[model samples]
Target chain A: MKWWLIAWREIRWEVFLDRASLLRTAIFVVIPIFFVFGNRGLPGGQAGEATIVALALQSVFFPSLAGVSLIAATFTAEKENGTLVPLLAAPIRDFDIVLGKLIGMVAPVLAACAVTLAAAYALASYRYGAERIAHTLTPQLIYALLVLSLLYLVTTGSVTMIVAARVRSSRAAQQLAGLVIAISAAVFGGLGVVASQLADGWALVAVGVLLVFFDVGALEIARRVWQRGEVIGRI
Target chain B: MIEVRNVTRRFDGVVALADASFEVRPGEIVALLGPNGAGKTTASRIIGGILAPSEGDVLVDGISVRVDPNGVRARCGFVTDQPSLYDRMPLLEYLAFFARLYDVSSPDHRAVELAKLLGLDDVLAKRLGAFSRGMRQKVAIARALVHDPPVLLLDEPATALDPEMAQTLRSFIVSLRARHRAILLTTHDLDEAQRIADRVVVLYKGRVIRIGATSEIRAGGKPSYLLAFAGEASAARDALSRIGIEAQPAASEDGLAALRFATDDPRRTNGAALRALLDAGIEVVTLAAEERSLEDAYLAILAEARQ
Candidate 1:
């Protein structure tokens, strides 16, 4: 007898008008294209193309921000409209409220990430199919994709719900979400600065481990915030 | 059945509710009457399991709301005065979604049934964003009733409805009572409370100062008879007093002359007041027995309680 109708209701409006934050969805998919194939031969030997494909696979992190924004925006909008309390007043647990909202955002955001990555993979194969992607994709690479996406989601899903729950102003939420995106960009760029030295399979494994660590860390911090009465403390 | 025993809820230094105690029996309609910010909403929320009381126990059908909150919530259908319905979803889908939350299966028939009961059939497919205030209120009501919980906590159930629509809701609440659903209604409209509530609890500040069966507490002491004559106002008061009826001059100036007599027995006062005037040959132009309004009784109770 538990459900997420409130959360579904929160996200449905975003999907229906194609109005609520489609621009973020667009940016999430489009930015990876530029990094994957646009600038070639930056770090390695004549293996310029394979590195780009690897980077494209690694850039599964982009949609993480999209998920955060969707959850944050949903909460901010509901609080502004005074709909949050009535929705919360329904027969659901306090924690379940956050879970439903996170599910609403994370599902759609992850779906968009999957679709955009498919398009990116097809383009990469068309250009350098005979080389880095000579055969169909490898299990190791698929594992990396699956693990990275999972980590990114667990981290962002938790953090975004907390951010959404704590804030009052929609502008504040947007600005706060914008701050998170900025931080993510810095982290992404910081990885590039150290990429030339450790440019190999070892580096890919290292980055994968780091992403998982950060994902777990962010989720724990978010879970703590949600439990401390910050989510439903106010109106 | 619900029981709130000396529940006091405080935030920091602000007291939202203090030592508030009241009860609702099975199949009872208890309208919580108070002015804005009089802790009406806070008390209702505590009962609905949306908020916890600072220092008291709220028991619902023998289950404490704080200890087994899910149990308390499961038995309640909660509705706010305003519609915070999720936007973008069709009204019916939203209801169906809540129906699922209550683990309510076969909701297609249930939604259709509630839609007809609440007159929400016409707008079932439309998104809630498109509904008017009245329509939205109906949808909010539908959301609460979808699960058919044993208890209904309603805050201004018809706040947004028109007069006729409010009448419909009032009657619908009566029907729910017939179904043995205990209802807690909070509204500013006293007449509505007078019309539908089996009992009324008036809250002042944060405590329940007065409560009983609606008609009992508001039944004031007893009825009083009023007499009016065109001429000789003092002469009429003297004439009525001779017959052992206390005829105090209510309006003794100019063309209007009136006297008031307090009596526990309405029939005796009605007969004696009329006979004294008629036998004395006093010109009794208007004579009527005034039944104390629930309003007058309410004000007196409030004024006395505040003191």
Candidate 2:
């Protein structure tokens, strides 16, 4: 319950109220529309397929990067601003603070992904047709865009939070988060290419299951590492 | 009540705090005085449960910090030197956030009440970034009181405040003491500590070198008196010598010759010294006992510890 309170506060202040975050989310939401328009000249079947892949990659890549940066700032920014001491001094449990920040940082990214997917769908359906777009939006692609994307967000967010807590400054955390994003984009982009070439949705679903395991492991590591003393000492 | 029992903290191989122990009773303020890098903040953080001790423990209202740090934290309110606040958040929301974390029944109500107590009710809707330094500090104090914890840890609460604002904060802290809270204040401002603290704990190199009442620490040396005389220095010296007391020539601004002497028993020796001067026909313009300040005692204590 206290974790929920912390998450809600973070979402309200850091995501919704922060102008820079809003701008990043807005750019992500608008990026997929351009991709949909770019594929407008293809045949109906090919255009529908291209739109799905493009949307999936856009949904996973952009928002996950955003989530990584946001999560990276979670501890380092608080430390830099001198807020971490009072936060650590609070009555809330250490795990709750870490879990709350993880959830809080991931929530906005997921919301932006949802928006980007919806916009891509509407634009692709208008450019081609609803039937073709519906035929291309299979269950496995949905899983890839939503479930797999969520797991990826969790994994990256947890790792970034750990990095944020360990680094001496926010700028250093952001640079490290950029490195995380680069590695993630390479792995995810390779998966997208493999799934596209093999024309196999279940293979991506199998990968999705693997990600669930990775997500749990990352979260466990985050919980065990982030303690009040460790957080305060970095500050 | 807060009892810090032989708490030691180390960073890597170096010791930040070594076997520091002190107690702050309910309704009492114990000032933790130290110089830079003296581990005052480390001790405060350990007591507040933000940092754990390397050894030993701190008990807040009988709750051991090592056993239940969150419970001890629940009973304590820590005010750091900087008013580190969420500048984008409104004052009331900021207070309510902490109140909720502390599990208050009515967070909004408690936030408003604390704002009122700190005379910040009118600016509850304002964002913290828009406030001045003093107002921000008041907001920080209000945030600490949101849960009404019985133990308050204030680390240089009046730091960087103007004279008027510092006086106001000092008055407010005294008022908090009136409510029977155990207050541990770590400050370099010896004057402030002398004015409000009931007991003073001197920490040197992460060790508690001295702990006693404020008056006892200030009166670390024998009581001394300065006698300003209208007569010559030779006459004042001769009078004091006749009384079997040695006096040193002291500076005086009013064109009066001054002689200073220390006495173990001021009540008895002062009267005898005055009688000797009067018998010698020396005109004593002023006979005042020199007051030893906390700063003086602090320096002397540190010097002794260093030696």
Candidate 3:
């Protein structure tokens, strides 16, 4: 279908080997590893662990922001540069654009996620110097980080793209996406504070389940909204 | 064939178009002519499946845009005045993007043919941002035509072109007719519309005022003749009216006479005037036939509508 074609084109399927996305993803993950451990010994308190986790979250955050730029840049830049009309007039559906955009957001987001995990692992091993990495490098921890990163991608990227689709300026969309990031960090930070006190796994699972529901719901909403039409009329 | 019936569209609190109706059959080029703020773009957008009309139905090849926008877009090609494209992309890449979007199995053929038609083959690989506006326009046109849709809608497609490029675009439109694509073009350039359109549609305030063949709509040598007499055009007109004619006083220049009459048959009006001059005892020194222009008739219609 034409819709799938748009998604494929948007995924930069042909440009998967491009260095820009790879560099953006790698730099996002590796930079924090540098700042977190400057050839220093490990800290031994609950506060240090929390800070380390928070730093890990930041690594997840910044590179994910790059994905935001890519998503917003796709639509807004197209509008500014005059490619929106031709694409809109193509024999494709609006849902195709939405799906294509969503597909496009995934790779960069996943790359950012990959970089975040590597940075987290590197920072853990360097600061703790072979002690904490051995203890915390469990299957549970890896799965938890993967689940958390996917949740972040869905929660942040969907809201960011919806805002992008509603605005004409690509810069404005990216800037607006910064707000979504702030809001997401606040919500997650609050949830983290609350979940730290929960009695068991059920509570965290409930929230994770809710996040998945919202993520799917957001994609569905995005698909329908874009199908309605573009952000602005043709000039 | 595309049929747009009673299409109306509103934006926020303002009505952009209302009670607009028109149709384009196969192989016809209909120009949607209007001044600024006349909702010409809205009409074109609706036909192109860009916007859903607030009311009425648009059927393209019997497919409704509102009901099946994807289907409608698949069958139509729309070239807006300013096409938004990626600055980093090559022209051919952009064309290929659209061709693939339209589900062209062999996009290379569509891309090559469209580039050739729009004369964009030379710039197919050039970065779009580096190209001039005219070059970009050509690429946009190529993108639209890549799908081989039966219907084409161009909104002031030649707005940024120089005279020669504009002429080439006009001929390109004429070539689309040979492809049997039904086209509806929106433009304020009367000369361009006059030259390229098979039928001209004059729209004002979101409604059609006139729709007919271009020659009929722009019959520059109008059939109205005005003559004025020094004393009274009635006596002169009375004599002139005798030969199946009707004449009225238009004006008096110096001491000579003048009267106005409507006669599509110039031969009949001329013969009647010659006989009337002799019968009225008016000096036969000078007799020149005058004709009203298409511009005059069109302007008068607008003036009357305003009143």
Off by over 4 Å in 3: A1-4, A7-31, A45-52, A69-73, A123-127, A220-230, B220-222, B225-298
What interface root-mean-square deviation (Å) does model 3 yield?
Answer: 3.2
Residue lDDT tens for model 3, A1-235: 6656665666654235446755765676666666576535546777656656656666566676567656655666666766566666666666667667766666657766766667667767766755666564555766676677768777777777677767778679878877887888789767866875796656777788889898778877776555433454522
Higher-TM-score candidate of 2 and 3: 2
Worst 10 residues of 3 chain B by lDDT: B285-294
Candidate 1: tens digits of C-alpha lDDT, residues B1-307: 8899889987666788899988998888998987677889889888887777889989988899889877888788888887787667787787887777777887777888889888788888898888888888888888889888889999888886899989988988999999999899999888899889999888888878788888886666656677777667677777777877776778554577788878887677677777877877787877777666667767887788778
Q: Give per-residue CA lDDT, model 2, range B133-169, as digits (tens).
A: 8998888788788889999999999998999999999
RMSD of each: 4.6, 2.9, 5.0
lDDT of 1: 0.74
**Judged by TM-score, which candidate is best?**
2
TM-score of chain B of each: 0.87, 0.91, 0.80
In the range B46-94, model 3's lDDT, one tens digit per residue, is 8888888989989999999889977998898888888666666677777
Backbone collision tally, model 2: 0
Residue A99's lDDT within candidate 3 is 62
| Candidate 1 segments exceeding 4 Å error | A1-18, A34-59, A128-130, A133-139, A184-233, B221-225, B232-282
lDDT of 3: 0.73
DockQ of 2: 0.73
